[model samples]
Target: MTQTLTVRRSAFTVALTLPVLATALLALPPGTAAAAAPASGSAIEWGPCAGMSGLDPRQQCGTVPVPLDHADPSGPRIDLAVSRIASGKPAARRGTLLIIPGGPGNAGLHEPSRRGRQLPQSVRDAYDVVSFDPRGTGRSAPVSCGLAHEDLAMERLRPWPAADGSIDANTATARRLADACQAGDTAVLRTMSTRNEARDIDRLRQALGERKLSAWGVSYGTYAGAVYAQMFPHRTDRWVLDSNDDPDPARVARGWLANYAVGVEDSFPDFADFAADPGNPDRLAARPGDVRPLFLALAARLDREPIPWPGANPAQLNGNVLRQTLLDSLYTKQRFPALARLIAAARDGGPLPAPNTPPDEAMQNTVAASLATICNDVDAWSGEGQAVYEKDVADSRARHPLTAGMPVNVMPCAFWDLGPSEPATRITPHGPSNVLMIQNERDVATPLAGARELRDALGDRARMVVVDSVGHAAYVDNGNACGDAKVTRFLLTGERPARDVYCAA
Candidate 1:
């Protein structure tokens, strides 16, 4: 779930790399006044959302105040920006359906307007769709590490190993990024963790006056939703976790990053099929079997003799850049063409496509928040040093050449200044049986293996609908009609499969 700074049509655009250490929440900085608390039970004074042109006209924006540290409710506070598109049919409305976004860093306040519009009519009529910017993202008391533009590039941010498989530069970069975060806004950044996000969701629930909440969480949102259901089991109604993560509390984000090795192996075949199809405008090979070797050879060649691409990030089409592109492209089949075209250009000496780097300021904000949440979520990764990471990278590269050692390489977390405030929350099968999970069989970000781990963790409290599809999200995005129908039915009628089911592609 590495954030792509490039603009794309999908909601799954947040990056996921790096880490931060957790420690006791920093004391309020000297002379900085704590934010005033909001009056209890005050309703959001909804109004036109600024800077969100092209948003659904019905979508209204507001903010809710929550403690900067949930552990100290009366201490300092920050506002969480929230948005809602009320039920299309108020009389038919059942309750609020929260849309938890992915990335841990992704701002979800606009999801109600974007993804909400894609909901089936029955769902739109049945609930007031709501979303929010998690504590340190978007307009919700946003934070930045003021990262240098060069460091913010995806190639650097994702920790791709040196062309020769050495992690020396990656290790150095990790330390530098960690130091930047330590020096910049440590107070607010330390508060960014999955546990606090769940707490913030509850605070948002209270502000919206919902006694209970039904939700649809995608990608990283799935993990956050699972945590919320665990923390406030009674407050959950119908819950849907799409594109789930492995809730191995001990590994947490570290496990998630390492999972990319398996995820890419599982997803690459789909891309191969797309690239080898004769009907595809950007076909890479005549036979599906040839695509893998061709890509490997081309990447290897690029590693040795990189192409100079003037406008692209890093200003070159090198092997790691190509590998990063493939990883990003595997998120969905719709992105397959882009990957194919890049390969064609690289192999044929054609012009490279323009790079889609996001604004430097936005990249800084997202990278900072992503690092904070993952690092602070668990301390499992804290003690690993250069040797440990080198071994991991070497092993990963040997087994999964497509992702190389990027997934297992060191991140900012290894050098973080703080430590986790509390132990990571272990998701267990003790919650209400309102949970339903829909997962793509070959999601490159949150693969089926991790989803199955979450399913096993949830036990009978959850039922899974595995779609024989490819891509990151399952429901209504990359899933087939069969999968979509099943998920929509559950959200609209609270009916789940009697046992785990599979929908054909």
Candidate 2:
């Protein structure tokens, strides 16, 4: 990944350690639907949660009924799964702040209970924290491709080119998967664009009767929050976008997909350093000199002669399969062992161990959801033919050898037939002036370059903090004191950094 020293960009209130379950939440009956909130300002109707079980009486869970297509609110609709732990401290209660997670596939409904528990008291005290599962994810109106059991494999789901760069199988897989999505609900699948998601957010805001929303959006959710802030600026207050992405209007998710190659390049060094550590029992190399070469050699060898990995999702370990495994494992330092173990075994000419595989029922759900959201969002493969990507895969394989042709290669999106419902919405300076950005200096998925682009796109409307660190995300990923303090302070108080500051790693 290229390190961009960027200046093109221009780019939260709260204070307190919020209580476990806000007293404000306890005031409302549990399990009330998000839609049930009356239009009355400052006073929301409440009821017991319908699906919540085993929770303390304070926790509330319910569904938010939203138009499948905002253009046709009276038509088909779906529910967004939601949960809330009202502000624990009634004294500092400001308003609700929604936590939007990444993955376009990540489930946030449980976050008010999981990640929310970690908020500083000031932040927790002031905000009635709420989170939800976006449409087609988690407990919402879920959609599955009904993919074959074998296709659920991650290596297969993401297109990894053949050893010699032939993309025949990739084309087939792309076509097969895209066909499944097209055959599903032609109406709602088309409704999965971020614009619709933004409209759904405003609807939620209107239902809650809040003049403004305090939001924490991370990764893919940053784009969602940015869109919400842009489309309904008056309704937003104290917006923080962490681990941002490139908000390129022309490509949208296409650009995001392509960014994966550079994302790996930016993040792999940390993994390299971890594997080079002297104390690592599963260390692949004694000296730092041996790490890259050893990884490259193992991948190339797997390309020339594959290994059998029975019990893994795909059941057989092929070249691209090993490459894909390497890519996913690079996301965290703790997972370095999975890569090292594979390399050490390959180097010693020993039998590669059988990978553990659990029941793939949930795996099916994950795969389907990933596709449904990505495909539903944008038209990735179009006039951009495979020729450009073929060269890219071959060139990237030569340059980064460890990841082989996996990241830059063709994916199911290459064959997707659906076009974006509307041109990708360009996030502009048109939104409210109250937005803060928190970024890790080195992020894998949402790289600094893209974040700079997003910052520039937002113009003078936002401020940013670059945490001196290397990882996929900053918040919850790095424990930097300054980074956390800056984030916590912003979330609790309406204050922001005097100027954009860079905290040392």
Candidate 3:
């Protein structure tokens, strides 16, 4: 089966009921009381990880049992897959540094070996790096909605409207996905929320016997890290949030999705520069300014006449598919050439590139978890009717033609049956002044605008480092030496710029 073109880094709802508000309040206390503490004498048995290739040999895997429903501690339990690579210089170890993965759906089981090893040696030596697959993901008793193959495509997942700008198909898709998830096993889906993920982190901290956790959270992980900081203020040491999202408590996931319009506009110029350079083989235009128009025209042309692409999801390269490809490619400059090539091929009637899709089973798991987290995070989405969505989509398309209203279009959350179990945790400046945010000036997935929102929300509790680079996830990935140096110093010596600092490309 052709795999869906998933948006790995990129990717809520609802108001708080009285009971939900109380649940949020009860979780404010620091330490074990704030989280569902694991049962006594139930520690993860560290051993070799199965089936993960290229993992660092030093990384060991384990599982910690967290309540399937945190509200009922003695109820059914699910095993959270955890991984760790002990400090290279254990004698100099200060504490644990949790490597939080993004996507809300992305697994962190391999992060201890992948991103963990990428850290500076001094930073690595200072802490035992650890990560985990949040509940309902990876080996943590995974859940799937069993969505059909076509529904898993990027254009559908991102809710791109029809070529005519009508959102009828998109709305239908939203309702269908919502129904599928509702009919599937919802036990684990109900438990998948950012708040619960924070609670899960605390549980892991307890299992590891750490009093506090210093963490590096990127992309969606940044939002997760902020929530953790808010819910357990005293338990976080040095915090690093990269490529942040807007943390409007009322909007939550909704705001993050809508921000893509701004993010793409911010990041596209860099790709235009690369794609229009005279020296580039895949140059799209004679001038950087022309690249945008060329792309737009090509997309419009494809909308009217899609080229058949055998063995690919949806089996053709249409305007929305091209648009989705552009969105995915803009995540990093390293991917710019691929986008350029695809655009050039589609325009010239060349053979289509092979589709990159994950196994059906993996796609199902990721989509299910992602939908559950965003939909179950809050009830804010349920109130927006189809007419409201149509107006929003039209407005979004008018303002941002590149994204074609997909960012603000209807999603499964709009039709989700299960409302939030608890209120979305509002991140505030009330936490310890220990956060350091690093953001790319032009990140498509998590734009600077949203990062600033998060930075502002944290108030005096955080300082931000703005890197004059394009792409997602600053600090060692798509970041300058100045920004990397700043983050590394903070991790190693607990030093931050006295205030927000900017780094030139």
- The lDDT for every candidate, in the order shown, is 0.84, 0.69, 0.83
- Report how far off residue 17 is in candidate 3 (Å): 10
TM-score: the better of candidates 2 and 3: 3
Model 1 TM-score relative to the real fold: 0.91
Q: Candidate 3 at residue 309, lDDT?
A: 86
lDDT (10s digit) by residue, model 1, range 1-505: 2221211111222233212222122222212212112223338989989989889999999999999977679999999999999876867887888999999789998899899988998999888899999988999888888888889889999999988888878877887888888886677898898988988998898888777788999999999999988877766778899999999999998999989999999999999988888888888899999999999999999999999988777889899999999999999888888788889999999988777768888888899899999988877766655677778889889999998899998888877756577777877766567788999999898989999999999887788999998888888896489889988888777777888999987
Worst 10 residues of 3 by lDDT: 2-11
**Which stretches in model 1 have alpha-carbon errors above 4 Å?**
1-42
Which regions of candidate 2 deviate over 4 angstroms? 1-58, 349-359
**Candidate 2 global TM-score:** 0.86
Cα lDDT over the full model 2: 0.69
Give the total clashing residue pairs for model 1.
10
lDDT by residue for model 2 over 1-505, one digit each (tens)?
2111111110111122322111111111111112112224533344565665654456577777898866567987888777778877776777888888677766676677777777777787888787777777768777667778778777777777777776667767777777776677655554665766777777777666676788889888899888776666666677889999898876677677667777777777777777889898877777776777777666777778777676787766666777776677766566778778877777787777768564566565566666656655555455456567677778877776666666666566655555455555667665445678999876767888889999998876787889877766676556888878877776666666767789887
Q: TM-score winner among the candidates?
A: 3
Worst 10 residues of 1 by lDDT: 1-10
Ranking by lDDT: 1, 3, 2
- The better-scoring model by TM-score among 1 and 2 is 1
TM-score per candidate: 0.91, 0.86, 0.92
